[model samples]
Target chain A: MSLQLLFDALSLGGIYAIAALGIALIFGVMQLVNFAHGQFIACAVFALILPSSQAVAELGLGRLPTPLLIPVILGFGAALALLAEAAVFRPLRNAAPVALMVASFALGVALQNLLLVIYGSRPKAVSLWAGLGHPVQIGGAQVPLLQLLVIGAVALILAGLALMLKHSRIGLEMRAAAQDFGMARLLGVRANRVISGAFALSGALAAVVALVMVAQTGVADVRMGGQIMLIAFIATVLGGMGSLAGAVAAGFAIGAASALLQMALPAEARPFRDAFLYGLVILVLLFRPQGLFAPAGAKPRV
Target chain B: MLSQHTIRRRMAASTPLVLALGLLAFVLLATTMGDRATARMATETLIRVTLVAGFWIFVGNSGVVSFGHAAFACVGAYVSAWLTLKPAMKGTLLPGLPDLIAAADWPALPAVLTGGALAALLALVSGAAILRLSGIAASIATFAFLAMVNTIWANWTPVTGGTSSVVGLDRYVTPWVALGWAVAALIAASLYGLSASGLALRATREDEVAASASGIDRYRHRLLAYVLSAFFCGVGGALMGHFIGVINPDAYYLNLTFLMLAMLVVGGIGSLSGAVAGVLALSLAVEGLVRMEKGVTLGATTFALPAGSQEIIIAAAMILVLIFRPAGLLAGREITLPARWVTGRGTTHNGPATDRRET
Candidate 1:
């Protein structure tokens, strides 16, 4: 039971960590909170199923082999992100953060409603890789093979991301842009290239999250991404707005806390877990408005 | 006999008066001449006006975009429902309510005021902590507060009927009543915007360091606006419940938050006139699109937009507005009387006070 609980926490935390990283990546380069990231995730999920207003979703691209399917979905996410950047965000590049945020929100509204038009509002069941649902004995706990894969995937992705950021030329430019965008540009780092790269990376992460969520729930709902997006948004702030490491850590922490709260609280009180979690979030902001991992220099100059 | 200062003030004041009269005209025309549906839309529009204006009191002045005001509205709606619902109905529907509330019944007006008051009290408590943070952190804190309130309200089943809506509310909110409240909100918002605290808050918004250096207590000023803003939001929520005759937690969550924020931003987030204008423009646009979706007979054929296309189009329009005029349609300027119209001269300078950026 203990191992099962630990696995539950890690798997959930892994999902949130990826989502948080997606949000943190965009915010790092362009100070806008992309509310449309949720829509992107939803779109990716919907991409797996053919466009239909019917209750049972037909497997569209999910019929493709795993290797090809992964690339197609990732490409879809990246292309959508790039299109949004060119159309919606590029013009508002110099606008106030509030304006950019609101514009992103409007874009989200458009995308969500568009999905509703195409797929209908009902939640659709799409069984992808049903074999992964079988349980495997890991120590004392019977964990689903999918959960273990999720944990492994999360670790691999994080490690690969860290190494790429540390070693690659584009990664270094991204870091430079995130730290001081104007200075980096003055020093000859291509602005558009870095920003577009960040968006694409963020979008790919969102696609990964979509795959995990669809596999876990075996259901695809238009509103599925909204809850995760909101939680990821909170995690992004709690981790320090622009800090990738902080966002991932915070996301994992929040997921673990949520799982623990679900276990610890009385049955009647379990439904109010989010209230307690959000209340804790407020308290944390009060104590560290700059976020938990915000560098000392991030403190606003008075 | 009027000094230039007094003249400018009156002209500036005419902005809200003109807006109120325009709303009054709309309400009167809709209720008297239009069908029941049109009248209902007018009332709903006025309620939105009250909400957006109330929202403007904090967001416009403090320059802090908050996602939490909808929670205040949710609380206000529930409070009004608890106060005004038939005692017998309350006993069955909300048995967890205190004896006094469960047993006693009240009229709509007092219940609405009580709702607003309770919401204000909530804002005072929450804003005390939230207003201490600045910029985006403050915005995030407000979002958290909204999430906390939503969870509590959605799960507090016995008292709130859980996710199921509280039905059979008295539909006492007529167009006239809504117009009255909307006008009152407009006046209050205008007064607050021109008040010392409002100016101080705006100063803080423009430059926090300078404002604090000038001995402006940013926290206190922001808190004041927040509480005042909550009062109006509460009133608007109560009115909405009375208008729709149903109260649900889902009604005042992210959708409502974004809707209100969209109106505020699209109208121009800098001024009170912008708030009212945004509400009016968006509501009319939405109503028109909804009608189009219902199909209009044009010549020999019926012309109609696809169902659910209104939201998409409106969202697209909002994005276009942001892209083209990021400051909003009004761009932070009030719709006041022109200088020539007021003073009978072609004076280009419309007093510095007319500019939202200036104190």
Candidate 2:
């Protein structure tokens, strides 16, 4: 039982960590909180299936074999992100953080409504890697094979991201830009290159999250990404705004806490679990407004 | 004999008065001349005006984008519903309400005020902790507060009716009543914008370090604006409940939050006039789109936009507006009398057209 809970927590946390990383990357390079990131996730999911109001979603691009399908989805996500950057974000690059945030929100609304127009307002079932749902016994706990794969995928992505950030030229520039964008630009790091790279990377992560979510739920709804996006947003802030490691750790911590709360709470109080969780978030903010993992230098100057 | 300072102050003051009169004329025209549907739209627009203006009282002055004001509205709506619903109705619908509330019946007027007061009280408590943070952290805290409120309201089944709608509200908020509230909101927002606390708050917004250095308490002023802002939001929420004759937790959630925020931002987040203008402009545009979706007869054929296209178009319009004029349509300027009209023709007025005090 304990092992099963652990896997559940890890899998859920991995999804949030990926989403939070996507949000944190753009926020690191630019101060804007990309509210449209949710739509990006939803768009990627819907791209897998054909546009129809039918109960069973017909496979569109999803019909491709796994090896080909993964790259297609990632590319689509990156292209979408690039298009949004060029159209909406580029023009408002110099606006206030609040203005940028609002613009992103408007973009998200437009995208979500567009999806609604195409797909209709109903959940559609799609069977992708249906065999992966089979239970695998490990240490006397029955866990789905997909849970282990999700964990493995998240670990691989994190490792790859970390290695790239540590070594590659674009990666180093991204780190420098994240730390201090203006300073990095002054030191010859290309602003457009770094921002675009961040957007593309963020979009790919969103696509990965979409794949994982669809594999788990086997259903795609227009509203699917909204809840996870909200939770990921909270995790991004809790982990500290621009701190990548912090975001992942905080995401895992929240998932663990949520899973534990589900087990611990009385039946009557279980429905209010999110209230307790969000209340705890406010308390955490009160005590550490700079975030739990933010570097000392990141603190706002009086 | 008016000094230049007095003349400018009066001119500045006329902005809100003119806005109020404009709303009043709209309400009168709609209620008197137009059909029932027109009156309903006008009433709804005025309620939005009240909400947006109330929201501006905090956001415009403190320069803090709060995602939590809709939660306050939700609270006010529920609270008013608790007080005004028939006693037998409450017993059946919300059996968990304390005997004092469940047994007593109240008139709409006092109940609405009570709702606002309770929401203000909630803000007072929440803002104390939330105001301590600054910048995006504060904004995140507000978002968390909103989530917590939403969760509680959505799940507190016995008292809140969970996700179900509470129906049979009195619908006392006619166009004129909504106009009264809207005009009152505009006046209150304008007064707050010009008050010492508002100025101090805006000072903090512009340059926090400098403002704090000048003996201004940023937290105190922010909390003051927050409480005041929530009061009006609560009132707006109560009025909305009465106007629609139904209240649901979902109605006051993210959709309302985004709608209010969109209106505020599109109108220019800097000025009171911008808030009112944004609401009116967007509301009218949305109404026209809704009508178009219902089909419009032109000559030989009837044409109509597809359903849900209005939301997409409006969002696209917002993006275009932001791209073209980042500061919003009015660009933080109040709709005051022209400088030449005020100063007389001979001297060319060289002062900036924008409201310097706001931005």
Candidate 3:
């Protein structure tokens, strides 16, 4: 039971970590919380199927061989993010953070509505690698193959991101921009290049989340991304707004807390798990409003 | 000779009066010329005015964006539902409601006031903890608060009917009733904006360090505004329940939260006039698009936008507005006596003399 619970926690945590990374990437550089990110994830999930008002998704990209499917879906996500940047965000780059936030929200609404127009309001079923749902016995425990895969994927992605941020030139620029945008610009970091780079990486991470979530649930829902997106957003804040590593760690912590709370709470009280989780969030903010792993200069000097 | 102070004060009072009159005129026009549907729409718009004005009280003055006001609205709606529903219906639909509440069936006015009072009490309790934080952190905390309230409301099935719509609310809201509450809300907001704490709060918003140095208690003032704002929002929620004749937890969820915020932002979060104007303009545009979606007869043919295109178009419009006019259409100014008209020609008054101080 313990080992199964451990797998459950890690799988949920992995999904949230990737989603948080996507949000943190954009926030680090631009100081804009992209509220439309949930929509981006939803769009990626929808991309797997042909556009139709029918209840069942016709496997469009999902029918492709794995090798071609991965790259195409990731590209779709990246292109969507880039299109949004050019069409909406880029024009309002110089506006106040609040204005940018509101615009992103508007963009999210537009995307959701567009999806509704194309696919209708009902949730669609998309079967991909259903064979992976089989439980595998390991070390006196039963864990699903997909859960193991999700954990591995999360680890691989985190390591790759760490190396990229450490060694790549664009990664260095992204870090600088996230740390201090005005100073980075003054110091000659290319603004448009870094911003676009961050958006691309964020979009790719969103796609990764979409694929995992679809695999786990065996369903594609326009509304599916919102719940995870909200949890990931909280993780980003709890980990510190611009801190990628912090976001990942906080994501894991939140997932673990949720799993344990579900296990420990009485059946009658289990429905209130989110209420308890969010209450903890408020308490954490009261104690350390800058977040647990906040970077330097997060607090006001005055 | 009247001093500048007295003139500014009178203009400050004039702003709300002007806004109330404008709203009243719209209500009257809708009632006289339009059908019942238009009257209902007008009522919805007025209820929104009350909400947005309530929203502006805190956000405009404190520069803090709150996502939890809808939770207060939720509280108000449910409270009003508990009060106004037939006691027999309550017994069946809300078995978990305390015996006293289940047994009592009250009229609408007192029910609405009690709903607002409950929400104000909640704001006071929550704000005591939440207002201690500042900036984006406070905003996030409010979001969490909203999530918490929603979760509880969804699960507390016996009392709230859980995720299902709680029906049987009396449809007591007319265009005139909405106008009356909206005017009351506007007057409250306007009076608060010109109050000493309101000025101090705005000062803190502009420059927190400077305001603190000048002896303003930012947290205290913020809490006061929050409580006052929650009261009107709660009333607005009760009014919405009466208007729609149904109350649902989902109605006051993130969708409503964002809708209210979008209205506030598009109107210009900086001033009262911006709030009022934003609601009127956007509500009109939305009503028009909704009609077009139902199909419009233009000259020879009936044309309709794609079924879901109204939301997409509205969202795109909001984004465009932000891109072009980030401070919103009003840019933090108010409708006031024109300098040319008030001071007469050749004086060439520099600006709206009392506008900046009022905002």
Which predicted model would earn the best DockQ? 1
lDDT of 2 by residue, B1-359 (tens): 45788678767777787788778888889889999999999999999999999999999999889989999999999999999999999999998999999987899889999999999999999998888887776877787788889889999989999999999998999888898899988999988888899999999999989999999999999999999999999999999999999999989987788889888878888888888888988898889999998999999999998777888888888888788877776688887765455655555567645343232
Q: Give the TM-score of candidate 2.
A: 0.95
Query: Chain A TM-scores, all candidates?
Result: 0.98, 0.97, 0.97
Model 3 interface root-mean-square deviation: 1.9
* Cα lDDT of model 2 by residue, A1-302, tens digit: 89889998998888889999999999989988888999999999999999987999999999999999999999999989988999999998888888788888889888888998888888999999899999999999999999999999999999999999999999999999988888999999999999999999999999999999899999999888777877788888889888888989988988888888888899999999988888777788788877778855576566
Question: DockQ numbers for every candidate?
Answer: 0.70, 0.65, 0.66
Scored against the true structure, residue B2 in model 3 reaches a CA lDDT of 55
Q: How do all the candidates rank in terms of lDDT, highest first? A: 1, 2, 3
Query: Which 10 successive residues of model 1 chain B have the least lDDT summed?
Result: B350-359
Q: What are the RMSD figures for all models against the true structure?
A: 3.3, 3.3, 3.1
lDDT of 1 at B282: 88
Clashing pairs in 2: none
lDDT of 1 at B136: 76
Error of 2 at A148 (Å): 0.9
Each model's lDDT comes to: 0.90, 0.89, 0.87
